[model samples]
Target chain A: MDAALKKNDKQLTVAEKTLIDTNLLKRISNGDQDAFSELYINYQPRLIKYCSRILKNDVALAADIVDEAMIEIWRSAGSFSGRSQPSTWIHSIARFRLIGYLRKNKELLQDESSEWLNFKDDALLPDEEIVLSERNRDLIKNIGKLSDKHKEVIELVYFRELSIKEIALMLDISENTVKTRMFYARNHLKNILSSLDLTDFG
Target chain B: MNKKQLKKRIPIEALKLLPWYATGWLSPQERGYIQKVLSQYPDFRSLLDAERKMINVVREDKSILDKSCLDATEIRLNKVLEQLSSTNEKNKKASKGVNQGVLVYLSNLVSSCSPKMQYAVIAAVTTVTIALSFAFVAPLLDENNVYYPATSGVKKSNNNLTTLLVGLNIEPTDPRLLKILDENNAKIDAIPSKSGMHHLTLSVKLNATQIKSLLKTLRDNKALFWFAGEEF
Candidate 1:
């Protein structure tokens, strides 16, 4: 698995990895609809994930935030500077949009823990249930069991790839608190994985 | 650097930062140090893989609706882009029209009169436009304008005191109608009627006796149909 992932990662040069988005933005500024489409296709899913993670997988709300952000991106594509990675810039934009969304709907975020209670259960397709390996499927099932605080840290750190500093600022917590939560999250995740199977921990 | 400094600088806690390393969020020197540590420490490679695997697993699980969301986003973004494009086009046309109209007005004003007459020109244009609009709408609103079709033919009549009954959709001017007036030397005129029907006219020289004969002929004429037993 490691070798396969390494092979995939090696296909893109560092320059290609970092500069392709910058180049896409440059093309977009010239009123290139194709470039805009390409960029939207790439960013939309990731932004949706980011927004939904906070809104606890309210996909409709997530989609709304993403679409609004995309409009703002299209209108201001010319103003993008390469001071930060494209993903970072986009994450910031999505973050700001989420902030606005939450400010408007304070009630939704109040019960974030309950928002995704049935999410993983519903996300499973019948074919995936048949075809996915039991271990990985069990991992997904177990991820849903973690507490909201631990799950939030794990998702923001490992899945979203947000820096601890950024996550701290977003959650209005200290950096040490973020790190402490990450440590507990990793330990709890390992415990969850170990509980799924015996041989790995042994 | 001293051996103590080198040992202190070695990145032991970098194992904990593997997720950030994978994300490329670390500074260049920190990344290099972490790389060096991982190269020397084979166990940490597995740790990195495990972190990477967890990231992939979580991302995969969270992206359950990626295709549907992407499609929704594409449709929405395209709509927004289309709206922006059309609005920009409309604004461009409107501004262009305004610029051209202002230029033409300025040129006409410069050529037509002194600066003192500019307000007069504008007032005249406004008044004429209002009058033209009123005239255009008045015909549509009036009842009088709805009538008055010269079904027989559209023509003016010069002979005065002409009377012709529009008797029940008959042939407009049958030969018998003129035969009744032929004894009086009736002159059929092509002049359009000012008030109403002028199907046939008799000269005054025909006098009352000829008129009586013409009336008798019209009353007994089989070519005419009398409705309600009235002398039409």
Candidate 2:
């Protein structure tokens, strides 16, 4: 029995980890600060990573966004339904907060100051600098060659890590429409990436 | 079936299936079907390879937030909680003071009303004074203005001329029909009326027979209204 339990534990996936964290969220909902802290520790890194992509690497701004979203999570944790997975719920919260932050600081997101700051920070990383390195830039340039709808699906799915169902919800489109977009986006991306030298990342 | 037969069976747009295939979202049965098709056609295999590379590039792009920022976020959240608690405490004390003041004022005001009943006796005299003023002025108002219904008949003037006037509750966008002393014509005028209706007065030079023909035309167009006259 012990050996069987050890084998099952060793095979635990990301989804399993998320399910365990959600139980912690249930306790946090009842005003358990310790459970809330545990939930935060489990999910904060991924949430921050997601925010960084959306906010484009202003650590302070990303921190502020994560702070606001987590605080909202703390306040509204009692309202979480098990209808969706906990990660999905938390992701929705993060996306909502990020959009709110962008709306409030519309000028900052648009102006050269944010981009300039990100560009300056690019030199700090040596191995895994920014994902949009020169090779990725070439890939993006070729992706720009695709139709707008095709490019949108690729960005939302791969870059944002949104599931097809989530993408359908976000875009207010049908699941078939999301699938169709993904189908075209993948094909177009394939065509573009084929022309470039992407073997280095591989 | 041969590779050519398989290629012909699958639509070219099925090439769009490559992304879902790369994501491993395709069901086992569907994957087997695709594999069998690909096996017979080796040329499409390179497209599948390219699809795989694209997925890799997308997944490898890491999220921008790091651990230190999340720690800082926790500290900021605690500060917000502290501020909220302090504000609630301050509000509680302020509200207690406001409730006491309001209660004391209401009690004093309620007690003062009973003894002041003699001063309240003047209200009846004030009402009678208002009633007398209204009775004296009402007839003068009636003499200055005449009330006309939406539909009325034409009245003859003192000079034996027949006149028809149309009254509208709304401003009429259409032209008006008028007959005066055996002649028939229509005019659109901006004349105002006393009782919130738009008025048009028509004086006819023609006889009543011609006036009837003009009135028929106005009636067909749903524009005719009966005339109202007061001998001033």
Candidate 3:
């Protein structure tokens, strides 16, 4: 489980959190500032991380993008038809903005620098676990080096835990394309990991 | 292929969905398909395990922003909130002006009439206004005025109690939910249905204003109640 899940365990189950998010969106539609604030607090960390990954780990720019997306979310909350999960709806808004930002600044998408490779060893682990964590960090660095198309599919699946259908809708691609990209992305990662002598990793 | 054959072999397209299946994020149909395959082909579990391992590694990378970026985000959010507040204020003001303008326009039109015509117009306006007011506002003040479930078809009976059908967001076992019910002088009349609908009975008869207040309280606690409506 991710940090968000861990946090939710202390307060709400996943189902409860989803219900609360839906209710918050309804309240936000009615000009409820408190509801909006609560939602912002809940989603800010998640959105910032998502946008950062897409924007070549530009955390500052990602924050600005998330803020822009949030304002849009506030204005458009009333029009949201509740057909999808609120998380999906919110992520779609952020993804739309992030894609638009990339369109205007194409160079940012092309810059695959190693500056995004920062990692911290925060947890105490056995020697084997330590080696695994080190290998994991390297894997993350390699993921950063993937092409934008391949990287996005991997990130959406492994990091965000979004359904393939949700990702296809967000990326405006066919589900087949999503699956193909995911396959190629995994193959690419596997090749790189093997090349790095990190064969213990899947 | 037969069903058994299909379960025995994993298609490339289905293999591509292994990551999501490992994450437990696939739709029920997809998940069921994958689960069926995994159950039949035990050795294929290795593929699923591999995907799970990769997921763990990816998630281990906590893509958290630095404190500086988080603080900046907070500042930006506050600015956006201020902008929204101003826009809301502007909308309220514009609506208020429109209302005032309509009243002023009507007053001027009535004033331009002759004295007899003006008196007749005034009498007519007053009669229409009063009739409209009674039509719109009488129910608001009526003691028996309460929300009715559209599907229930039950009307208010002559009693000192009202039933409210509520959908709870919190678990039914939560003590805080009981406390909320107690605060409203309500009790669970029926255990929650599978869909989470709870029938709560207000112990005392409440007037329209009280019901409105109670509904407002229930609606405001969005984290607790998904929905609340009286069963009159």
Residues forming the 10-long window of minimal summed lDDT in candidate 3 chain A: A113-122
Q: Could you arrange the candidates by DockQ from highest to lowest?
A: 3, 1, 2
Task: Score candidate 2 by DockQ.
Answer: 0.04
- Tell me the deviation in Å of residue B143 in model 2: 64
Higher-DockQ candidate of 1 and 2: 1
Quote the lDDT for B76 in model 1: 59
lDDT tens digits by residue: candidate 1, B1-232: 5422433344536745666787777768768988988888655676676767666655666532111212344565687678768977998999999999988986778579866787777778789889986776454443445422233222233245544332211444557645545765664434423211234555553445655656455545534522101111
After superposition, which runs of candidate 1 have C-alpha atoms over 4 Å from their true positions?
Answer: A1-14, A109-202, B1-77, B97-232
- Measured against the true structure, the TM-scores of the candidates, in listed sequence, are 0.34, 0.30, 0.35
Q: Model 1: which docking level applies?
A: incorrect
The native-contact fractions of the candidates, in order shown, are 0.12, 0.07, 0.26
Best candidate (score: lDDT): 3
What is candidate 3's lDDT per residue for B1-232, written digit by digit as tens? 4532433366655677788888888889998888887787775687777667666655664231100223433455688799888988998999999999989988998889999998998899899999987776565443657743332323435478877666665777679888987787878744664324587788888887887788778766767765565532
lDDT value, residue A83 of candidate 2: 53
Q: Which candidate's DockQ is highest? A: 3
Q: What is the lDDT of candidate 2?
A: 0.52
Ranking according to TM-score, highest score first: 3, 1, 2
